[model samples]
Target: MTKHMDLPEIIPIFPLPGALLLPRARLPLHLFEPRYLAMLDDALKTPERLIGMVQPNRMPGRNGGTGLHTIGCVGRVTQFSETEDGRYMITLTGLSRFRVVEEVEGFSPYRRAKVSWTGFERDKGPSETDDGFSRDKFMNLLSRYFTAQELQTDWESLKEADDELLINSLSMLLGFEPEDKQALLEAPSLSTRRETLVTLIEYSMRGGDGEDIMQ
Candidate 1:
């Protein structure tokens, strides 16, 4: 992670099979499995419990899941509660992009990594966006898709959102396929990611199958 006196020493990361992290958005997750349970315990004992959320690239064998994509967003653990079975219900707020520097050989059921963050180092802001009717058309289609899914959202809030937050949030949470999510997440800038997301959203709105993520 980039070192700034303001940013925490360790930005928390939570790796999940299918979950995705959108910057500036908060995701609530449950920590139940043994390895993750241990991870949560470790975080609880630390000053800042930050986690990275990444999606699996293959099916896992031990946790009975699979491999994860290379990139993920670092999140901070801002809230926590307990379940009856000793699991954790925690809220993770997205912070920055983290690249797994290397894998650590471990005995735990889940994977862990030594990571490097690029938030302070890189300009995450989008240089420009696709203007004109394309953006408007995509928004119209996305609104319809949301309507069909029975999800309620505040359009005003979304419209007012910064470009980075809007693109990242939609890229993570929208109806795109796994690979598409990765594409959006890995886009070099907020503008490019939004353009890609809009394209994917349009395809989904038209009932098309986005490509598989692993390929």
Candidate 2:
């Protein structure tokens, strides 16, 4: 037997550079920019307060526009509060991955996309059975990398965190190159993402250089 998630159309999007929000992790966005402030307004009026969080390839183009990476995660706006001047404070909970079908033109100042997410499936967070040598090895590499970066961490919680939390946690903590982080975000499976991150952390530990680490 199989099940499917109910996907919502008219998904709002926020294209950010160097921003990668993985499934099962929380992304807090402070909507101060005028364009984004308008975006929040539209999302609030809709029943599904969800937005696709995508990263741009480079700097906002000379025209203040940027090229988006093909893949992204759609997040649901779980918390929202507004400021007197109109800024929005919100926390987006990760939902599932989406592939851009094409960019949608918006009347608002910010860019929007008519994203295609029908094929994407959100993993059911991971189960207890997902832990093993592969996971521990990855964590070990992460620990060493943390030491090299002089980052203080909670080993107890990391050790005890389930697969989904651990993966997202490592993603947020490790020194992943932008392209590499994008790759991890695009990776299809948890185990694959684990291996990819382990490889990157190992390379970073070896020389802290911004080199492609995944082999």
Candidate 3:
């Protein structure tokens, strides 16, 4: 178990678009790029073995570089293996979501940032339970959304997952836009994240043009 104090103030960040890592969820990544490979190497040397996963903002930064979203989740490398071709396959188990304080100037090829974990102290605690979750209604919406997107899944498995697992997994795995995923990541609570997930699916079903497709 990772205590709140176990998390570091400065950590490496991977600015991947459309990739979301929620607390208590696992994210698998394949690292082949030179910079990312270096990032993995450095992370392995740390005691926490953690890396921050953030989505790159669509807008450009003041320095004319790609800007990262303000919020991101930190993941610890729980599983890792090196490939014959020098690539690395790793699985990150999410620990907490953090707000970026500022990007640090560093000699590493990858980016690093100073982060604050004040508001997200709960992330290090036990998994959350959403009392307001309507399993049947949520599943119905998910079925329609999956059908429209032609996505296949094990319904039984999804049903077996707890509230936080189900919602967070869908938020991470669903083919929502980067912005939509960011919204889910920044949601303050489980119920709020579930609501945002439903809305995004509803908007997508409407072709994102404000049409009444439910009729």
Candidate 4:
């Protein structure tokens, strides 16, 4: 995929409430909805292969195309293929985070946003590792969380994973509510995200609802 010197002013967004894409992270999406299929078709034809992954303001409204959160990550369509069932399976490699400047007028079936990359300029840098992160604490909390949720995993693979992979992959895979996922996505730094994840895991283990962390 080609690197972007800067984010585009107008871009199409895929408003998936619980789905998020962080810089340098890869997000896999299955496009079945007609509107999104059209969006993917357009993206496939473009050289940039860009798509903004955003969350809707509400759950039920997501299917009806509601207002979106201001912050989102831009991803490039790195891998794509069409299924016999007419669905488009694509993997997006995240590029940068962008804040919506305004909505643009468009006739396309998909939504478009005028965005600014001023706030997330740091995304172009290298990925964060476990240098100063509390990896041990994080892992302990993760173990508790998995047991609490009754989720099974391959311990060997998980332990062998790097800091970035472990943090980002679990952040996306965990059963956090949309808002909680958004908090992680919009975190200012990797360290901040790690702290937030630890806090949420602790709350869940204490018989408190995980979603209540934001409240």
Instruction: Give each model a TM-score.
Output: 0.74, 0.82, 0.93, 0.88
TM-score of 2: 0.82
lDDT of 2 by residue, 17-39 (tens): 65678766778888999888877
The best-first sequence of candidates by TM-score reads 3, 4, 2, 1
Query: What lDDT does each candidate get?
Result: 0.64, 0.71, 0.90, 0.81
lDDT of 1 by residue, 129-155 (tens): 434324455567668778777889989
How far does residue 90 in candidate 2 sit from its true spot (Å)? 1.8
Q: Where does candidate 2 stray beyond 4 Å? A: 1-5, 59-66, 83-86, 122-133, 208-215
Candidate achieving higher TM-score, 2 or 3: 3
Which parts of model 1 are misplaced by more than 4 Å?
A: 1-13, 59-66, 107-109, 118-120, 123-138, 148-150, 209-215
Clashes in model 3: which pairs?
A: none
Per candidate, the number of residue pairs that clash is: 13, 1, 0, 0
Model 4, 1-215: lDDT tens per residue? Answer: 34545557899998897997988889999999999998998988987889999888764534234478778899999998889999988999988988877777788999988888887877877777757776666677677778878999988887888888788888888878889989999888877887777776767677665453222
**Model 1 alpha-carbon miss at residue 57, Å:** 1.6
